[model samples]
Target: MKKLLILVLMLAAAFLIYRFAFKKKRAPREKPVPVAVSEQSAGFNQSMNSILSSYYRMTEGFVNWDTAAVGSAATGLETALKQLNVEELKKDTTIYQTALYPLELAKTNTATIAAGRDWTERRHALNDLSDNIRTLLLTIKYDQAPVYWQECPMAFGEGESGDWLSSKAEIINPYLGNKDPKYGKSMLNCGENKMTIDFTKRDSARLK
Candidate 1:
């Protein structure tokens, strides 16, 4: 009976060691990462995004020197500009009135691009459009992402230069264009970053 009792105790100990100490462990479940989104800014951001999308397409057209593509994209950009959430600008009385001017100017520039007589005319209009768009963004306190303001020293001529806005800092000279038979791709990357416009909420400290 004593031997049997000791045998039973040893078996129970072995079972406990296998179940509690040496048992295969199950892998832990992973937690999902939370996505941050602001509903208040969604509409304004979307509207601005649409405008930039069309604007970038227009820039691409200019870079390729495709007149038809530029005209089409210019029309698209004008339409996008019209759909801007101007009401958002009304939140700040100071900028509310100031914002409309640049918006109108941008639209006008787009229209000019659409009806431009030649590549030179359209390119000039695009440069004006870029300036107006940048002003509008500054007036509206754009907070989505940084916009790179770039300048090409000899874009128009040896003594004339032009500025443009881009999402990336990398220079892609729309005025020079890759389609230039002589320069080919030599002048495509000719430009310097003038400034970076970033008004994200995290950068609110800058306003102070």
Candidate 2:
């Protein structure tokens, strides 16, 4: 009985040592590093900023229900779109193809907006134009300005939503606009901010 007790105590001591001391130490888990936004030429950055500015102007026209102003802003957007140094984007084949897809669509939609006179159709075209421009910015990772993506649930018809970009977080919805026959400006602030697009990197091309 004495021998058995001694052996049991020895075994318990060994088990305790193995449990606490023999286990391997684990390495601390590394936190993921955020990928930075890509850099572009000063000209590219300027052109993108100009395009965004023109888009904002167009949004204002929509909000104010000024057809002529909207048309003019659309034209200005086309000019700014042309100023973008597309060749600089061509160096990266993957990015070139992706960026051009939306850029081309922007061209088409802007042209439609500039030429169309139908109010409802023009508003719809602006929705398409807004999407294409947003896609282009995202594809190129444009990080110059603060772009706010907003959506109005009843901009078109009940249950149908429309989206537009703005320079501010405050939702002065371009759709439903400022002129409602029944309730003036009642629905002007009728949208919720979806997200703010700001991928600006720490690099130097940010002179906007």
Candidate 3:
């Protein structure tokens, strides 16, 4: 009777141990969902492509002295503008209002070599637009910029066609004494420009 009681108590303890200690733990947590690249984003991307294509065609026409080609490309610009969801963009951000001015000007103008010269004027408008677009894309991907900036290398050189894409590449490795990197906070071209960002090193890029 004593042996049977001891055996029963041991079994009960084993059952309790199995129920409490051997139970499965929860799976690890998942990362947060990124913003979707939805139909709207796709449409915006298409419009941007159309605009850039038309601009290129218009410039090519001017270079070749083809007035008809320039006119066709100008018409293409109008089509691209029509595809743009101006009202939707305006609702989301004030950036559209700023971009619309130059776009309107470009649309109404006659095709001429002089029209090509208006690029600088148009660019001021478009640069703001581009900045907004980049911000939107980044927001979609990361929800926000990372708390920590990652370091990567980029190449330093002008384009093959001698376009002044970059005046020069100033690489300030924080590990070294050099300060004030030119590409500042951008991640897009770090590797292309052959400059390594040193996150491990002391930061010297801040303005003194």
lDDT of all predictions, in order shown?
A: 0.86, 0.86, 0.42
**Tens digit per residue, CA lDDT, model 2, 1-208:** 9999999999999999988999777898875555444578877888898999999999899889899899999999999988788879887998898988888889888898899868788889999999998888887888776789999998887898999998899999888888866557899999899988888765344432
| CA displacement after TM-score superposition, residue 31 of candidate 1 (Å) | 14
lDDT string for model 3 (7-126, tens) is 999999999999899988889887554433332455665665566566556534533445576568767866775676655556545555565665555444422322545433332332
Q: Work out the TM-score per prediction.
A: 0.77, 0.77, 0.36
lDDT of 2: 0.86
Q: What is the overall TM-score of model 3 with all chains considered together?
A: 0.36
> What TM-score does candidate 2 reach?
0.77
Clashes of each: 0, 0, 12
Give the per-residue lDDT of model 1 (tens digit) for 1-208: 9999999999999999999999988998765554433323788888998998899999999999898899899889988999997877676778879988999999999999999999889888888999999998887767777899999998788978888899998999999989876688799999899988887653333332
